[model samples]
Target: MKTLTEHDIRSSFVNCSKGEAKRLPLPKQLADIDHWDALDFLGWFDLSAPDRSYLVAERGDEVIGVTLRSPSAKRGFLRRSMCSLCLTSHPGSGVSLMSARKAGRAGREGNSVGLYICADLDCSLYVRGKKQPAPGGRMEESLTVEQQIERTRGHLDAFLERLFV
Candidate 1:
């Protein structure tokens, strides 16, 4: 991953109108992010619009971005959920089900794809131990950190591929 600018991110969106992308709130302190090289994608929830979220990733030479939405009702707090991307288990509502509108005609017809992901969109950090989940949240794995990162990226790429279907 490489450091990206606001313009780069805004222009990378594939599933939303340019105007909507322009209005979408970016992650705060874009310039201050020190983990660019560690990220497979940039993802964040919109604080101003609770149901809205965004993700941007580099695929080959192009950067692809998508708009995602989460249900208004929160998930149950008593259940532990695992992120499909990083396979990290989080207690309670720490995992969220987020759906992205498909690109092209499918999207116009209200078609979308969903996945269970980290609520904070910090899969990269979690896989690398740069961030921690609740006590006993992380499962012990035989895979090394690099393997975990690769698995996470593979999951994300598969999700992104679904946007075009």
Candidate 2:
């Protein structure tokens, strides 16, 4: 993982709204962060929740950022009662609330862990894919855009595994 600055981290995002991304609290060790290892940073609103948190990871500063929100009592997505990170198909909609489970050695003593990912496919890149058509309307040829997205999803899954288990 390569190190990154708050500015670099903020500038890297392409999913969330610019205003919302800028408002997020920079990680305490932003200067020390490995931006290359970071897949991406995650941030959301706090209007009806506690303080906002940012999780950033990079793969040589060239991968999708993996982010998890801090634990909150309001239970935005967590209230769904499903694993937000899970995407397995179920008979009914399985929306689960994201819980901050303790991670690493610190998790044993009441550390934060887990988060609410879409029970279905992750909604981020999916939306992007749907909006953008293949170049020259060619579906057979592989494009850099498709490759980047595929790699990003792989990185996201790996990061979630590391954070959760």
Candidate 3:
């Protein structure tokens, strides 16, 4: 992944109005995020609009972005939840049900897909051993770490593509 600027992020949005994209927040450490190798994509929540979030990932040379909505956490309800994107389980504060409105007119007509995603959108870091997975969060996997990372990125990329296609 290449280092992306705020402009890259803003212009990359495919599922939100320009005004909304302009208002979205960049990750606080974006400029200082030198460890691009540790990230499969970039995601962040807007502090002012807690319900709003965004994701951007580079596919080939193109940067793709999607706007997401953060539903209120259903705390203590689903005790053993796994993120649909990364397959990382969260016995505690590890996942949030995030939804993305479909792109173009379908979105305006109320089409969307919701999935349990890492609450902080830090799955890449977690998968790479940079961050600790919550207790009881680990899943049994025969795949090597590199293979798991590849699988996670594949799932995430395919999910993001759904908003546009």
The best candidate by lDDT is 1
Better of 1 and 3 by TM-score: 1
Better model by lDDT: candidate 1 vs candidate 3: 1
> Which residue pairs in candidate 1 have backbone atoms (N, alpha carbon, C) closer than 3 angstroms, thus clashing?
none
Q: What is the lDDT of residue 18 in candidate 2?
A: 60
Q: Point out the higher-scoring one by lDDT: 1 or 2.
A: 1
Encode model 1's per-residue lDDT on 11-126: one tens digit a residue.
99989989999999999988899889999899987989998899999887889999999878887778999999999899878888999999988998999999999988999999
**What would the TM-scores of all predictions be?**
0.96, 0.34, 0.91
What's the lDDT of the predicted structure labeled candidate 1? 0.91
How many residue pairs collide in each prediction? 0, 36, 0
The runs of at least 3 residues in candidate 3 whose Cα sits more than 4 Å from the true structure, single-residue gaps closed, are none
Model 1 misplacement above 4 A: none
Q: Which ten residues in a row have the lowest lDDT in candidate 3?
A: 71-80
Report the CA-based lDDT of candidate 2 relative to the real structure.
0.42
- Give lDDT per model, in order: 0.91, 0.42, 0.83
**RMSD to native, candidate 2:** 15.3
Lowest lDDT sum, 10 consecutive residues, model 2, at 83-92
